[model samples]
Target: MIDQLFLNNFKAFRSASIRLAPVTLLTGLNSSGKSTVLQSLALLRQSYDSGILMSIDGDTDSYGGFLLDGDLVELGTGQDLLHEDFASNPPGADPRISIAFTTTDKQQYGWTAQYVPEQDVLPLNLAIGPSDWRDAALFSRRFQYLQADRITPATTYPRSHHQAIGRGFLGARGEHAVNFLRHHAQDVVPEGHPLRHPEAGGHTLLDQVVAWMQELCPGVNLEASEIPGIDSVRLSFGFGGTAGLDSTRRRRPTNVGFGLTYALPIVVACLTAGPGSLILLENPEAHLHPRGQSRMASLIAAAASAGAQLIVETHSDHVLDGTRLAVKQGRLAAGDTAVHFFRGNGAGVEIITPTVAEDGSLSEWPEGFFDESENTLDQLLG
Candidate 1:
C-alpha cells in the first residue's frame, strides 16, 4: 500500500504530501482540490500503462514521459496540469511537475516531467525510482478507478473482450461494468473474505454483489447478459414478491430506480477487491439515500479490511459516520483509516486531517466537515 503521496508543482498544489491508509476518506466542498488528488494517481497510472513512465535505454525522451492523454485519465497539455503558482526552482533550472510516493515497504518512487504548454507528452527527465518498485500494489493489475460522473441507467452497455475480460477494467465511467459482470459472474470469491456476504446464495462474485445491492433496496436482484449478435451487454433488475413485484419478471435498468445502476460499479469494484488491490472511488455515495449511503460505507470498510486500499471522495455525512461505526465495531482499526477535509478559497487550497480514535470519535472537526446540518439546526432553533 502507498503510505504517502507527494505532489510538487502539480495541478492546484505547489507542494503537498498526503498520508494514506487502508481506508482514506477525502471530504470537502466542490473543486477544493479533492478530485485533483485522485487525478494525480490516475495520471500516473495512465502514463505507466502507455509505457511513458518506464525506463529508457539511453535517452530519457526515447521511452519514458508523462502521457497527457491516455485510457485512465485525459489531462490536457502540460500547462493544464502544472500548478498555476509553482514553487521556485534553482537558478537556470526549468519548471517541472513531479509526483512521488512512499510505500509501506519503505520504498520511495518518483517521476519528473518537463513542462510544454501545447505538448500532450511531458517528456520525463528521470526514470521510475527503483526496479523493484514496479511491483508495488498501486501498479498491480487489480487497480480500479471509478470517476464521479459514472454511467446512469442504461438499456445496453458496451462489451469489450480485452478490457472487460483480459484487463478486468470497469472503465473510468464504469461503462464496461455490465460486460465485466457477465464475464466474471461465476468466479468464486475467496473464503474468509469480507466481501463474502453472509446472506449471499454462494461464494460467487455475482452472489456477493446481489447481497450487497439488497442493502440499497431489499429483495432486489440483478442480471447481466449479452446481446445475441451485438457487441453489447444488457443489465436488468428484479424485485421479489416482498417489493410488490413479480419475482419472475425482469426490468431493464431504465425501468428500475437510478440508485441501483448508479451504485453498481461501486458495488462490483468493492466485491472484486482483494489483497494488494487499489481502488479509487469518486463520490461512491452519489444518488444513494441516507441509509444506503451508510451501507455503502460498510462495504468500503469491509473491502479495506479484506486487504485492499480504498481512497474515497464523498460529501455524505452518513458515509463518514458509518466509517466511524466500522471502527467502533472493530471491523476496521482506527489507525487503518484516515479522514481529510479539503477547504479552498480563490487563492489556495488547504487540507486538514482529523485523527480517528479507537472509539471511532474524531480528534477534531473542522468548520465545514459535515457540520452543515448542525449549522442549519442552530439557525432554526435560535
Candidate 2:
C-alpha cells in the first residue's frame, strides 16, 4: 500500500505531503484539489503504461517521459498540469513538477518532470526510486481507477480481450466492465472473503456481483453476454420484485434505474479486490439514493477488510457515515482509515484530517465538512 504521497508544483498544490492508510477518504468542496490527488497517481500509472516511467539507461532524449495523454488520463500539456505558482528551478530556469510516494514497505519513489509550456510529454529530469518501482504497491497490475464520469446505461459495451480479459481492467470509464463480467462470470470468489456475498447462490463472480447489486436495489439480477460476430458485449438486469419492481421480465440497462448500471463497475471492482490491490474511486455514491450510498461505503469498507487499499474522493455524507458505521461494527479498524477534507484558502488548497475513533466518532468536524444538512436545517429553523 502507498503510505504517503508527496506532490510538488502539481496543480493546486505547490508542495504537499499526505499520509495515507488502507482506506483513505478524500472529501472536500469542488475544485479544492480532491481530484488532484487521484490524478497525480493516475499520471504515474499512465506514464508507466506507456513505458515512459521505466528506467532508461541511455541519454534521456524523448525515449522516456511522462505521457500526458493516455488510456488512463488526459492531462493535456505541461502548462495545464504545472501549478499556477510553480517553483522555478533557479534564477533563469523554468518551473518543474514533482510527484513522489512512499510505499508501506518503506520504498520511496520520486519523479521530476520539466515544465515545457507547449509540450504534452514533459521530459523527465530524474526518475528516482528502488529501480524495481514497478513492483511497488501502487504500480502493480492490481490497480484500478474508476473516474466520476463513468459509463451510463448503454445498449452494449466494448469487448477488449487485452484490456478486460488480459489485464482485468474495468476501463477508466468502466467501458470494459460488461465484457469483464461476462468473461469472469464463472470465476470463483475465494471463500472467507468479505466480497463473497452470503446470499449469493454460488461463489462465482457474477453471483457475488448480483448479491452486492441487490444492496442498492434488492433482487436485482444481472447478465453479461457477447453480441455474436461483434466486438461488443451486452448487459441486462432482472428484478425479483423484491424492491417492488417487475421480476418476470429481463430488461436492458436503459430500462433499469440509473443507479444500478452506474454502480456496476464499483461492485465488480470491489468483488475482485485482492491483497495489495489499489482501487481509486471518484464519487462511488453518484446517482445513488441515501441508503444505496451508505451501502456503497459498506462495500468499500468490506473490500478494504479483504486487504485492498482504496482511495475514494466523495462529497456524500452517507458515504462518510457508512464508513464510520463500518468502524463501529469492526468491519474496518479506525487506524486503518484516513479522512482528509480539502478546501481552498484563497491562496491554495488546505487539507484537514479528522481522526476516526473506535466508536465511530470523529475527532473534529471542520466547518463545511459533511455538515451541509445541519447547516441548512439551522437556517430554516432560525
Candidate 3:
C-alpha cells in the first residue's frame, strides 16, 4: 500500500505531501485539487503502461519519460500539468515536475520529469527507488482506475482480450467492465473474504456483483454475455419488482435507470479487487441516490479491509458518513482510514485532514467539509 504521496509543481500543488492509509478519502469542493491527487497517481501508472516509467540502463532520458496522454489519462502537455507560477524553479536546470510515493514498507519511489512546454512526453530526468518499481502494486495487475465520466447506459460494451482478459484491466472509463464480468462471472470470491457479500446468492463473482448492485436497487440482478460473433459484450438487468417494476423481463442497460449502468464498474471493481490491489476511484457517488452513495462507501471500506488500497475522490457527505459508520462498525480500522478535505488557495491548494475516531466521530469537521446540508437548512430557517 502507498503510505504517502508527494507532488511538486504538479497541477494545483506547488508542493504537497499527503499521508495515506488503506482507505484514503479525498473530499472537497469543485476544482479544489481533489482530482489532482488521483491524477498524479494515474499519471505515473499511464507512464509506466507506456514504458516511460521503467528503469533502463540506456539513455533513460530518451527511453523513459512521462507519457502525458495514454490509456489511463490524457493530461495533454507539460504546461497543463505544471503549477501556474510555481514558487520555486531553479534558474538554470530544466524545470522539473516531480511525483513520488512512499510504500507502507518504508520505500520511496520518486520520479522527476523535465517539463517541456509542448512535449506530451516529459523526459525523465531522474527516477529514485529500487530498480524494479514495477513490482509495486501501482503497476501490478491488481489495479483499477475508474474515471468519473464512466460509461452510460449502453446496449453493448467492448470486449478486449488483452485488456479485459489478459491484463485484467477494466478500462479507464470502465468500458471493459461488461466483458470482464462475462469472463470472470464464475470466479469465486474466496470464503472468509471481506469482499464476499453475505447476502449474495452464491460465491460467484456475478453473484456478489448482483448482491452488491441490489443495494443500489433492491432485487436487481444482472448478466453479461458475448453478443454472438461480435467483439462486444452485452449487459442486461433483471428486477424483482421490488420497486413495482416488471420482474420477469430481462432489459438492456438502456432500459433501466442510469444509475445501475454508471455504477456497475465500481461494484465490479470493488468486488473483484483482491489483496494488494490499488483502486483509484473518482466520484463513486455520482448518479447514486443518497442511500446508495453511502452503501458504496461501505463497500469501499470492505474492499480496503480485504487488503486493497483505495484512494477515492468524492463530493458526497453520505460517502463520508458511511465511511465513518464503517469505522465504528469495525469493518475498517479508524487508523487505517484517512480523510483529506482540499480547498483552493490563491495559486495552489490547501489540504485539511480530519481524523476518524473509533466511534464513527471525526476529530474535527472543518467548515465547508460535508456541511452543505446544514448550511442550507440554516439558510432556510433564517
Instruction: Score every model by TM-score.
Output: 0.95, 0.95, 0.95
lDDT of candidate 1 at residue 85, scale 0 to 100? 85
Tens digits of per-residue lDDT for model 2, 1-382? 8999999999999989998888999999999999999999999998888777747333455346788889888888988998998777674677879899988888878888888888889988877777566777566779899999999998999999999988888999988888998998989988888878788877788888888898898778888888999999999888774312235677999888789888999999998998899999999999999999999999999999889999999999999999999999999999999999999999898999999999999999999998889989999999
lDDT of 3 by residue, 1-382 (tens): 8999999988889899998898999999898999889999999999888776747334454447899898888888899988886645665666689999899888879988888989899988777787667789989999899999999998889989999999999989999999999999989888898988888878788888988899998888888888888899988898773211235788988889789998999999998877799999999999999999999998999999888999999999899999999999999999999999999767568899999999989989988898888999999999
Model 2: how far residue 355 lies from native, Å: 0.9
List pairs with backbone clashes in candidate 2. none
lDDT of each: 0.87, 0.88, 0.88
Q: After superposition, how far is residue 184 of candidate 3 from its true place, in Å?
A: 0.8
Candidate 2 similarity to native, TM-score: 0.95
Give per-candidate clash totals: 1, 0, 0
Q: What is the TM-score of candidate 3?
A: 0.95
**C-alpha RMSD (angstroms) for model 3:** 2.4
